[model samples]
Target: MFRVLHRAGQSHDLTYVVVVIGVVVVHVVLVLVLVIVVVVVAVIGGVEVVLVLVIVVVVVVVVVVVVVVAAEAASAPVPIVLTTVTFLFGERTWR
Candidate 1:
């Protein structure tokens, strides 16, 4: 009976050691993963900001060009006559 108790005690101590080691290893791995995620997000965040700015600039340029062209078309005499005719007849009359 004494020998059986001793063997049980030894096994319990071994299990405790294994649990402690596993906990430490898991904590270290979690910390490393967190650090990697933060680094990747920081680098990608800068690139995303630049890409968004470029898209905004391109959209602004396109809007400005469209507005300028529409203004010119409205101001021209031929388009004005064509618009009036289309309005009255439901279709454009081209001479």
Candidate 2:
């Protein structure tokens, strides 16, 4: 009976160790997965920021071009009679 009890106690200790090892493994895997997910999210956010910056730069360039073109057109001279005739008809008819 004594020997049997000793054997049972030994087995119980081994079971506890196995359970602790399993828990530790699960915890480590979870931490690794979390790290990967965070890295992916950061990379995606960085790419999004870059894309937005590119779009903003393009819009600014287009706005500048439009402003410059409008200023040039405003500064150009037009004969009053020619302007009136063209407005009544069209540039295609004048050509």
Query: What's the lDDT for all of these models?
Result: 0.50, 0.50
RMSD of each: 34.2, 36.9
Give the poorly placed runs of model 1, Cα more than 4 Å off: 1-12, 46-95
| Superposition error at 27 for model 2 (Å) | 0.9
Tens digit of per-residue lDDT, candidate 1, span 1-95: 23323543687755434333443454467567555655676577876765665566557656864675477457653343333334345442544
TM-score of each model, in listed order: 0.36, 0.35
Clashing pairs in 1: none
Off by over 4 Å in 2: 1-12, 46-95
How well does candidate 2 score on lDDT at residue 9?
65
Residue pairs in collision within model 2: none
Across 1-95, the per-residue lDDT of candidate 2 in tens digits comes to 23323543677755434333443454467567555655675577776765665566557656864675466447634333333334445545566
